[model samples]
Target: MTEPNLPSGNDTDTNSSAIPGTAAAWERATLERLAMATLIEQRQARRWRNGIRIAWLVFVAAVAWFGWERGAAPADVSKPHTAVIEIKGEIAAGGDASAEQVVSSMRSAFEDSGTQAVVLLINSPGGSPVQAGIINDEIHRLKAKYHKPVYAVVEEMCASAAYYIASGADKIFVDKASIVGSIGVLMDGFGFTGLMDKLGVERRLMTAGENKGFLDPFSPQTEKQRAYAQTMLDQIHQQFIGVVKAGRGNRLKETPETFSGLFWTGQQAVEMGLVDQLGNLDYVAREVVKAEELVDYTRRDNVAERLVKRFGASIGEGSVHALKLAPSLR
Candidate 1:
């Protein structure tokens, strides 16, 4: 009687319930995975759409800027006018008033048949002497070849390297109150040896040549190195003096303070023979050149160059930071 007994109803019901629960769990998990995959795909699609829109906007902006720059070329040069070239801001190798820009503009002005004369509109606190020297030499050469009188019209301030280039002009005109002159050469730097000593820091610099690290700020500068630097500066000063003397000739009223690296008012400069007269661009064009119309021929950085420079500024900044560890000229 005991062997013939079957399974209980409760056991059968529990087994059947367990099988449906497991299957339901598996189906729910699969549905969840499918929903998550759809969400991920939607997010990726949205990102791609945003990226494309941004790229299209940038492309359109670049094209429009380029077109505007190209269409902004100067008008015809074959018209009677006074050719004006601006020498404004710092005179450096890659600046707006650099030797290359100024020289190129001068050539264009001088070659034009209708150009009555070339005028330099200078406004600067001065910069690199090497750049100034190149421009000064080019001025003399162009004048000799073209036989066109080149005049310098000063506004606001013109000192140091700016005056260096102006010296080559046939005549320099300045406003009565304009600042002028700074006839000298300089090599400025700083020393941190005492500070480093106080901080208990050591500079372990290695060089093949004995004087290779002479200009290093953290290291102590020897008397011999100082003398060598002074000699170099003196030679450059003499060269600058010679250029001014040759340019001004008998007109310059030489005095002890003339080449002492001092600046003066435009009125005082006129009295000292450093400037010709009190005038302006309009006055020079109308009275001197007898050409009323002024035509500008200044070369400037184009739209594309400016954009490239702006984007590459971070790279340039990193290079400058590295260069700061080494000695350099101003």
Candidate 2:
């Protein structure tokens, strides 16, 4: 009876009980692995979502910045009121320092509503009379159109035609170290008649008019030619004097020699009535315009455009510098 009662502890029933325990352990391990895999998936999903959100935010910010910069929108008048327009370099027909560029800048300055006044920062030796005239006329037009006061500031040097452009301003300012008042016209060339004679060179020029070859290097100048040239220069000089007088009004104290193509220091210019005030641009803006904030309505150049202009300027400066460095026989 005892033998047949039940299997012992090492019997099949006991082993079967151990099998269920092992199966339960395996199931627990499987469930733990599943939980770890789920946790990893969730973490990866959250990280991916955060990364996508950050990328989207960056894209939106870039778009907004570029839009504000490049879009055709209204002027941002968050700061000062007066607009500054620079008239730098030579006033020529085709150059960065050209009448057209100056005139365009003036026009844009007046066009902007935020521009309460204008400051023309002039630093030039001179170039073309016609170009200067165009700039002067545009300045006049803009001043009258906007009913805004225009102040001209001479930086280092404002000579000849450069002064012509500045003369149109309501008030001219100059610093103590600045040079002003080179109020005349010049056309220069060398006559090589003697050199050509020594070199056995013959003159071979065809002209229908007798005066066409008047200042030819190979020909000798006549009394009439000299007289005619003087008359022309005189006429141009008188025109310059008249314009300066008109623009400066009762402020100018002119003698026969004031407009005789003479330059003066800024201090001397103030004493001689060539400049209205002996002050810099900041002084003028602070006193006359009565504002510390200034706006430069100058159209900003893009990266590519700036690079091109600088490249051209560099090439120009390099060539001129190279020529100057070249040795000369004389």
Candidate 3:
């Protein structure tokens, strides 16, 4: 076998050389497949990123549109129109019916040359005497400066500070069945001291000033503090009474029960001289203002404003909680 080179042996060598070529080809194919897979994954990731970007743009555009729509004036400013300012819901500092919003709206309405009159559409259970006072003061000032009549049209209800605000108007219009009047001031809270005593829990309150924790619900309130609080409430109530008297003038029918925190129907309010006449917003716009085209100049919170306010309130509340302070009054 050694003497002559066998063809069969040569064939075995050839087969051995072909084996490496076949393995190299297989490796190249595998590498190509891996590269293709990587390319597909990259394309998919890019598509996802593009989609996310597009979605974010759409969201931003929608928000911008919504904000514009919410804040834009509905009617043309060139024609004579009844400028309507809404005072709805709780009239708190950060609310839609806040003093800042109402006052600003009134100022704009009064400043407009095309405005015939300003109308306050009031529908609230009332809140914050301070807010109401600011609005009332602005109404009087604007009325004096602009020489334009300001009328209040009561909807379902107008009580407490709501009535305080309404009284500033030149005249108050109301529906016969609408609820009105709650001319009073009060500071309301609950005593948790008794509950804590029953539960065997002691209150740990620390204050820099002697009367700093005067109204703390967890602590026991002394008779002196109670009397002081009552005196303060009485003073505020007197101030409220003065405003109502001044606003209504001799038109108001003085009665002992009138300022007793009692609410009455609009018909009863008219009888008591708390309201001028039974009428609605449309009636006031058409008959009183002589302008059927109503334009709203009410200052309202847009999406961004509302978000900022909510965020600020949350931060303030958190800080107050961390300081272990009771909720503050307006």
**Predicted candidate 1, C-alpha RMSD:** 5.5
Q: Over all chains combined, what TM-score does candidate 3 have?
A: 0.77
Each prediction's whole-model lDDT (CA): 0.90, 0.80, 0.90
Ranking by TM-score: 1, 3, 2
State the number of backbone clashes in model 3: 0
The model with the greater lDDT, 2 or 3, is 3
Error of 3 at 95 (Å): 0.7
Clash pairs (backbone) in predicted model 2: 80-293
Kindly give the number of clashing pairs for every candidate. 0, 1, 0
User: Residue 95 in candidate 2 has what lDDT?
Assistant: 64
Quote each prediction's TM-score: 0.80, 0.68, 0.77
TM-score, cand. 1: 0.80
Worst 10 residues of 3 by lDDT: 66-75
- lDDT tens per residue, model 1, 160-279: 999999999999999999999999988988999999999999999877678988998989999999999999999989988998998888889999999999999999999999989999
Each candidate's root-mean-square deviation in Å? Answer: 5.5, 19.8, 8.7
Stretches > 4 Å off in candidate 1:
1-64, 67-73, 315-330
